[model samples]
Target: MTSERASPRRRDTWIVLAAALLARLAVVAWAASRFPPTADGTFYHRIAERVAAGLGYTWLWPDGVVTYAAHYPVGYPALLGGAYAIFGAHPGVAMTLNALLGALAAVAVHRLAARAAPPGAALAAGLLAALHPGLVAYTPALMSEGVTASLVACAAWAAAWVRDAVPLGARRTIAARTALLGVVVGLATLVRPQSLVFAPLFALLALAPLAGPRARRATLGFAALATACALAVCAPWTIRNCERMNRCALVSVNGGWNLLIGADPASTGAWSPIKVPDACREVWDEAGKDACFGRAATLYITEHPGAWLSLVPRKLAATFDYCGAAGWYLHESNGAACGDRCKLGLGVVETVYERGVLGLALLGLARASAESRARRIATRAVVGVGLVFLFLVHAWVAYAALVVAALFGGRTLLRGPVLPAAAVTVLGATLLTHAVFFGAGRYGLVTFPLLAGMAGLVLAGFRTRA
Candidate 1:
């Protein structure tokens, strides 16, 4: 009798897994059909192909056209290049790898949610994550966002599990698990340096449940080990950048440009040359300007105090504005050529117009409620750590805010006494930072799985109450 029941349960589990896998594959196929090769896709894919074809990493193409001069990190191209070499240089193969990574990310989300909530809520979270439109849009592209996001999700899951292990008095096991989390985080940083922001936040979140001298010492020791491990993995790339360019830059030369673009007085999708005073522009344009862009932006802000002050609120609004549009707007010498047919149409525009008011209100209320719950010292510490890293690195305040709101909603759903408050606090910190900087739809993707899990918890509660 027991064996028969267990066999049926096992079969049901397999069926569910198969269904989830199929759902993700179907989304990947649909995305592959909809969007052709984007400009970024063309650049990354071509470079990967070149790398696979035995072209040295630093060689410039003819007529001053450069292919691999550090526009992005080497990890993603290297991964895609290896894929191309093994499976023939096909876009489909590269996209398939991304789809697989995204699907694995869903699994990781399921594991994390399951640890916190019931099995039903966990399944719902996984399904919602699989169906999220933003994830759907980006997973098949050759861009690093989908893969990087997946890595981060995995790292977060590993970190959370490590935390769970540590509290259960498993010191050696926790140390091993935490080290693994560090390795995952290191790889994530290699794919996109921005993920380094999560390192300190993870440390704080991990240490929250521990107390006493022994726990503190263990926490510190484990954190140091993890940091050393991450640094060891990252050291090679850092050394390569320094040797190749004679500049000791750890990551890409895009942070300043990103900050300038995010804070600039341009429309949603626009790009412009970095403009400082003549002397400052020259100084800031040098390879060493990666460290100077912040100073230059600060100087710009100081000089145009009123204009800079006004940009804060404007940037906040821009971050949340869902025009449902796509891509950067480029200008031709002759006239403004609105390239690409992905522009918002009547239906998309109307949807945005209708939903804007309600979405904003719900978002605000959710954020406020989360903040109120996060008033404790521990929660404050988490928010502080995340915010400091966010301000120093990127400036997508609106995206941050939306994540916080969604987290608040998630916490509200779970009814767990502790995590909801912390989740909401992190969300608030994300929003406040986003408001001061900029936002993007892709940046908000990280929080959706958590939010979806939270939403599932909420719906379950409603059903139970009804």
Candidate 2:
């Protein structure tokens, strides 16, 4: 780790990246042949097509219903729109771009590992991300996951530098690092608003590593500057939403509607579509419906707190099932609805991916923590084992108890080890957010880079004690 004895850094990095890209391209080719882009992507493609044609982001129906777009984020479509503009609405081109993004994401993961631990670990992390099965398969899809993953990885790498290195660097250096973090995170947020959550959370956690007399001021300064830049980056979208929609929409209107989706009376907290009540549709526009749905969700949760709590375990189950049944790893082919067998097969794939690949990342992170004495992962280990046991026994209460204990017991660890804390916080936030609203397998994809970096640390091992 001190210096790679066997190979040069750039050579290793490119090797990892090239291999990852090749694998992704191969997977993209196979998937493109076997599966078509699903509905989730169909809308993105339609909007991109509309935009490419100079029609603006608008949708029209036969019933004289004219709607302006406010449902999804603009960034991914904007990327697709650019591709369409150049190549003219080709799915192959889009998939190729997605694969390219996934490869770049692998590079980001490599840098993240190198920053957090030793340089030797970087290639391992990159390789883990490159070969990650779900990551490879998702590369061919029209979903935002590929773009969001790449951005999040780059942001995470920048954030690691800000949190782990900036406090010790020069004054201007700190500012530059913080601003860069902001720029990357802001871009990621445009792709998926969930990226915004990391700014505040990581800022708060950044306070952990600053230890000098000036640590407090430095922490506050870093947080304030980073957050300011992020908010500034999002200003254009916020202003556009407000001016156009006649409402102050900081991001897409999907949050409230998503909240409502999870708060349904019959909701199990998994991603299931329910028919909107006529009352919900009384308001014509998505903005109005989102507001109405938010209120309805709030009312439902208030009136049925017990029901909400009951769904927590199910949601948590789905969220952390790793590759089990929920979270962001759910693989649907061609956006077509799957029968029970395919759903079950996807669950098995996720389980395999989570246990095998994610477990590698977890192990790598633990090793990194151990090598750097970053922060202990004893509590994290317990939680991992608990989840595995839960998978076997299907005893939600047992795993819930373990998770709660880990949350309380792990604070000391979280306070010291920045990457582990970041990783755990990401997993916790993703799981809790989805459980509170609704979850799909892809929701868990956001944490992939962090895990890969940790896995890299493990591979780096004890600095080959001279």
On TM-score, the leading prediction is 2
Q: Alpha carbon lDDT of residue 24, candidate 2?
A: 81
After the best TM-score superposition of candidate 1, give how far the Cα of residue 55 lies from its true spot, in angstroms. 3.2
lDDT by residue for model 2 over 77-179, one digit each (tens)? 8788888999878778788888888888888777655545545666776787777766775676788866887887777667667665544667677778778
337 in model 1: Cα distance from truth in Å?
19
**TM-score of candidate 2 relative to the true fold:** 0.84
Give candidate 1 misplaced runs (Cα > 4 Å).
Answer: 1-21, 27-35, 64-68, 263-273, 280-286, 289-295, 302-306, 323-438, 462-466
Query: Model 1 misses residue 41 by how many Å?
Result: 2.2
Model 1 per-residue lDDT at 117 = 56
- Per-residue C-alpha lDDT of model 1 across residues 295-351, encoded as one tens digit per residue: 666666667767655666555444433422123311111112223443334224423
lDDT score for residue 201 of model 2: 64
